[model samples]
Target: MAREKKYREAVNWKKELRLFPGYLILLIWISFTFVLLGWVLLASFSTTKEIFSNKLLASGLHFENYVKAWINSDVAGIFRNSLVYSIIACSLLIVICAPAAYVLSRFIFPGNKLIQTGFVSAMGVPVVMIVLPLFGIVANLGILNHVLSNGMLLIFLYIGINIPYTTIFLMTFFGNLSRAFEEAAAIDGCPPTKTFWLIMLPMAQPGIITVTIFNFINIWNEYFISLIFANSDQLRPIAVGLYSMINSMKYTGDWAGMFAAVVIVFLPTFILYIFLSEKIIAGVTGGGVKG
Candidate 1:
């Protein structure tokens, strides 16, 4: 009973009364999220009539909602497209950013700060400002009508827009790494490039995983760029494609089907966070130490 009382006061409301308001707000927010997601999950398996009546799951589980959404609705195509774009873009971002970040963080070359400042400034530029010029170039080049080029164009834009953020993020990770590793590698006759690739890069895995997750989520959910450049139906990613699907579903009145589609779209990021959340926190607050 003494232990139980002590445990009950784990929050120490008497001593931390000032924090009670913040905790209350966080609790409210969590409650709201749980209620919202619960409703969506329930609605996905319910019939349209059940959803309208707020009597979800009254009729047994309707697995066909997912089947219909996945097949008849063409969620599979857009899902595949988003997956491919995100994976390729994330891989390329790491490859390009890792070396650039290593150089920027470790070396004191001429105009290094200027280059970093340029990247930081680039991130501040609104996408709307450049969209028109980008469209004009692509349209004039006549690649927008070609399916293969159109897909490639989307990937290129994703990589271009993301470079600044990726480089900046990884630079923090690389900067946190110990120079002792490099010195030791040099003593052992390892080339700088080999040291970076074989030793330093792997040591920065936490930060890389964290930043890659961010990049993947960004590319996966990107709507405006894909909408502008994905000129064809087949080239569309999940965001724009899901928008069109939902709009069409509005006409069909398939409420359950729409919710099922939403859940499908939400799964990848949800699962990713579920698994790598610890790594993300570690990346943000962690660094290598010198012996």
Candidate 2:
């Protein structure tokens, strides 16, 4: 009886320990994330006076700062530019990357492995390394130093940069799909193109949606490329626009306005993540886990 009780007690203790570690880790992570986010939120409502005085926690919130930032500053225009560029880039990425991934995943050819290897290699190249060459190319094309040029060139650049990862992810999804469906469709007199469009593409919806969301976020948040290529205030995205606002602090001394600008810049991505987070998670996790 004593030996049996001891074994049962030990097992219960182990189970309790397992629960404690997981809970502790989760609590720590949650606390860290919340603390960081809380700082940003607090800063967004604080003025330069509050910040410099080191009494931000005791200062009153300045909600009017958002209005001034939005209407008076160039923040609205910047957001518009970001929206336009991101929309164009994401749309092109979806149209081009989807079909390419499907073909690459489905077809067997002499250079198939070589093509895939090249894509994987491209993924390893850092954005900083590519930026200089891209700038030179844009300059050679005589579109450098123009805002519209920046927006137009960035669409193509973002698409190209994101394509490798998008293709690889969709390739895994496409490859895991059963061949039986395509074979059956072919046996029913469907052409390869028709089979791909009518059958396979619909089934790949989850992966496509997931990739599109990722592309959207990437294009929306991209700063380095836009900063390098775009020169004018009208063509600046939120990232560049926010930087400009902060820089203007030297002249205007409006810390509240800058904080408001930060909040405005952060809103779109936060709202998007809040609404589509479940779908994004499901789409990514569901793709090809079986195969």
Local accuracy of candidate 1 as per-residue lDDT tens digits, 50-149:
9998899999899899999999999999999999899888999899998999999999999999999988888888889889999999999999989999
Question: Tens digit of lDDT per residue, candidate 2, span 66-104?
Answer: 778888886888888888888888877777877888899
Candidate 1 residue 224 Cα shift, in angstroms, is 0.9
**C-alpha lDDT score of every prediction, in listed order:** 0.89, 0.79
lDDT of model 2, residue 289: 24
In the predicted model 2, the residue pairs found to clash are: none
Q: Model 1: runs farther than 4 Å from truth?
A: 1-22, 281-291
**Model 2 worst lDDT run, 10 consecutive residues:** 282-291
